[model samples]
Target: MEWLLTPGPVQLHPKALEALSRPQLHHRTEPARALFLEARSLLKRAFGTEGEVLVLTGSGTLAMEALAQNLFAPGERVLVPVYGKFSERFYEIALAAGLRAERLDLPYGRVPRPEDVAQRGFQGLLLVHSETSTGALVDLPALARAFKEANPEGLVGADMVTSLLVREVALEAYGVDAAVSGSQKGLMCPPGLGFVALSPRALERLKPRGYYLDLARELKAQREGESAWTPAINLVGAVKAVLEAVMPHLEAHLALKAWQNALLYQVGEALGLRPVPEVKSPAVAAFYLPEGVPYGAVKEAFARRNAVIAGGQGPLKGRIFRLSLMGAYDRYEALGVAALFREALADILPAS
Candidate 1:
C-alpha cells in the first residue's frame, strides 16, 4: 500500500511489524515480564511523566474509559469541553461512568480556550488534547495550568491518542493528571494496546470500577513486572520495539509534527482545499471537500493509486475528508506522499 493514512491502525515501523509477528510468549514467563517492564519504562518517557504508565490490552478508547472510571468518584462534577468527535467521546465516557459531566459544547472545528474551561469550575476536567475528527489540537499546557490554578485539587485527564508521539506531551510539566494513548497512531505500531500515563495524584485517586479495566489492580501487578490478566503479548512486543527505536533519538520522532503540518499545508494550498479546523493537528488534517466532489469519488481516486486517506467523522462526514501524517514517515517519504496527494486530487477534481 502506498499509504495507510486513516486515523488509526497506521502503517507500522519495520521493527514493530517484525516484533508483532514474532512467536508468542507466555505472559507469566520471565522474558515476557521483562518485555512488559521495559515497555512501561519507555512509555513513561513517551508521556514525559515520572509517574506510572499502565499498558492495557485494548484500544485507546479503553484507556479513556479506564481514566473516566478510575480518576474520579461517582457524582463528581467533571467538566468536558466538547469540540469534535473524540472530545465528545471523552464527555460520553465520563457520563457513562456516573460522573456529573458538564459539557462545554463548541462547534466541530472550534478550539476551546483555557480560560473559558477554567471558568466553568468542576472537580475534574476530561479533554482531548488533539481531536482527530476535526484535526484540532488544543493548548494543553495552558489549559492544564489554568485548570490547576482554578481548582487545585481537581484532576485533569487528556486523550493524547493523536498527540502522543506527534507532539511533546509533558504530563508532569503541564500538570496533566492522566493521559490516554494507543499503539497505532504515533507509536507506529498496529492497533491493540492502550496506555494510561498517570501522575502520582491520579494514581492515588484511582478507584477501580470494573475488573478487566481496573487500573488499581493493573498498577499493582505492573509494578511487579506482570499483567493482571492475559496480556496482548505480541502487541506488547511491538510497542517495546517501536519505543526502543524512538526513545533513544527522541527529537526525530517529535519532528513528525512539523513535517506533517508542512506537507498538509502545502497540499491544501496547492489543491485549493480549506482546512476544517482553525488550529490544525499535525497528527491528522481535515479539509472541506470541494463542492460537487463526493467522498466516494475521492476515496476511489486515492484507491486507484494504492493510497488511502480518511473521511471526516460525525456531522462533518460527507462534507469533509481527512489525511494523516502519522507513522514513521521521514522527509523523503513525506515528499513522495505529498506528490501522490496532488496526483490523487488531480484524479478526483473535474477538468478545469
Candidate 2:
C-alpha cells in the first residue's frame, strides 16, 4: 500500500515482483543463460542500441566506475559538468579512479552552456542527462555534439540514470560514446542490476580492463551470452518481466508522463509552490517549499497519506523537494499524492 515517488528504487510492478518470486536457478545453467540472453536483448531494444548492453550486479555507480576504468588511462583528463548530486558523483568517481578531471560547475538547475565546456582540453566528457536532484535536464544533443566537435577522439559518457527508459534519448544519433542506467528507473524493476551501452568509438578506446569494473570484458562475455562475474539472476528475471510489460505500453507511458507534468504544474500553481528550475522532468518533478514550512514535516505528512516523495540532495536539502513521476504509477495515483502534498502545504503555510 506504500507509494514510492523517489527516483531510484522506484515502485516495482506486480508482474516484476512475481518474476522475482520464481525459484532460483544456477547462474551457469542453461536456464540462467536463457534468462540472461532475454534480459540483454530486451535491454538493447529498450536502449535502441545494437551495441552490447553489459549487465552489472551492482547499482548504476558500478557502471560509472566501469566507464572510467575501461575508457581512460590514469592521468587522462576528463571533463565533468556538475549540475546536481548525481553529476557530482561522476566527478568523484573520475577523481577516485585517478583520472585528471576538470569540472564545469553550474548552479543547480542551470545547464552549462556548450561554449563553457569547449575551452577545456579533455579526452572525455561525463554528463548527466537528467539531474534528478533539482529536476534539471541537460541538452543531450547539444552537449554530445559539443564534445564530439571539440575532440573527435574524445569519449562522451553519460549518466542516463534518471532518463533512460522513461524518455527518448537517441544515443547513437546523438553521438554519446557511453551511457549507464539502473534497473529501477524506467525499467520498473528493483535496484540491483545496472546497464551500460558503449558506442564503437568507446569500444575502440578500451584498454586493459580491470577484472570487476571492466566494460570490455563484460561486453565480450555478454556477447557470448555470459557474464564475467555472477549475475543478478533475480533482478535480471524481474527486468525481463518489466521490459515485457513496458514494451507494449511505451506510448501510454509517455502520454501518462505528459499528463502528470501538466498536473504537477497545475497543483504547484494552486499551492503557490514554485518548481526549482521552472522546468519539469518527465521522470521527476522538484519543487521549492514555501517559507516557514519544514521539508521533513511535509515528508512526514505525505507518509501519513501513504505516499513517499524525495527531498533535495546536497546544498538544496531543505529548500527543495522532489516527486518522481516515473515507474508503474499512473495519473490517478500521482494526483492522489499531489492532493496530499497540497493539503500538507496548506496545513504548514500561511494563507496569502
Candidate 3:
C-alpha cells in the first residue's frame, strides 16, 4: 500500500472516507442540523472547552484570518511569536488584517519562552501550538497563562491546526480566547472544514469583519444548528463520522504518541539524521538530512517507492525533510511505514 507521510491533507480515515461518499443532506434539514450540532459538541471536547465551536467552509487559514479580523480592530498591536513557517503565516495574516503585528522572532528550532512573551506589551497575542514546518511544539498553556497575566484585558488566539486532535489542549483552562483548526491534519478528514473554538469572553468581543468570515454572524447561525451560507455538507458528514467513530479511543491516542516517539528515535538514529527542533512534535517530525545527502534525491527515491514525504518550505527549503503521523495509523501500518522508510533510504545511500 502507498504511504502518505506529508504534514497535511493526510490519508483519510476509513470511516471518514466512507462518510464522505454517503449521500448528501440538505443543510437546512433537521437531520443535517443534528449532524452539524453533534459535530460541534465533539469539536468542543477535542478542544477541551465548554465554549462555542464555529465551523466554516474553508481551510485553517480562513479561520486564522477570521480570528485576526474579529478579535482586534485595525491598528491594534498584536504579538506574534514566530518560530517556523506556519507561525510566520500568522504574523503575515495579522499584518494583512491591518493589525500592528509585532513579531517576536526566534530560531527555527526554538520557541519563545512564556516569561519572555509576557514582557511584550501588545493588546493581543497570536500563537501556533505546533509548528508543522520545524516540527516544534510550543508550551501553549504556559504561554496563554503568561499572556493573560500580562494583559488581563487582552485576547489570546491560537492556531491549533496541527495540534487539535493530535495533542491535548485546554483552551478554557489556559485562558486562550480562541483557537482555530482544520479537518485535514489531526482530524483525518478532507480539507474543506475549518473550526474556531471561542471562549465566552472572545464571543463577547467579536464584531463584524467581512461578509463570509464575520464570526459574529456565523456564531449566531451555528448556535441554532444552521449555517449563514451553504456549507460543505459532505465534508461536515465526514467530520461527524471521524469525531464519533474514531475519536473516542483514548488508548489509541496514547499508543500513537508512544509509537511516534519510538519510531522517530529509532529511525532517525539508524539514518544518522538529527532532529531539527529543540522540542519535537508528535504529529510532525523534521530532521536535517545527513551530510551530502541530496534532499531531492531522497524525496524522489521515497516517491518511487510510493511513500510520500515532504521537503522543507520557504527559508528551510532543501535543508530538511518532514514526516507526518497525523492519520489513524495502527500498529501494523506504523511498522509498515518504518520499514518502507528504511527501504527508501537504502535506495539512495551508498552501498556498504
Q: What is the lDDT of candidate 1?
A: 0.87
**Angstrom error at residue 28, model 3:** 0.9
Candidate 1: where is the Cα deviation over 4 Å? 350-352
Off by over 4 Å in 3: none
**Model 3 Cα displacement at 287 (Å)?**
0.6
Which rank order by TM-score, best down to worst? Answer: 1, 3, 2
lDDT of candidate 1 over 148-207, digit per residue (tens) = 888988899999999988888888788899999999999998889899999877877777
Under the 3 Å rule for N, CA and C atoms, how many clashes does model 2 have?
0
Candidate with best lDDT: 1
Clashes of each: 0, 0, 0
> What is the C-alpha lDDT profile of model 3 across 1-352, one tens digit per residue?
6788888988888988898777878999999999999999899888888889999999999999998998899999999988999889999999999999999889887888988779556889999988989988888889988987888888999999998878777788877989999999988998998998998888888856888999889988999889888999788888888889756785578568557746965786688778888887787878888678879988988898888899988778888998887876777787788887788878877666
Give a tens-digit lDDT track for model 2, residues 203-227.
Answer: 7778646888877678778876789
Better of 2 and 3 by TM-score: 3
- What are the models' TM-scores? 0.97, 0.95, 0.96
Q: Lowest summed lDDT over 10 consecutive residues: which window, candidate 1?
A: 253-262
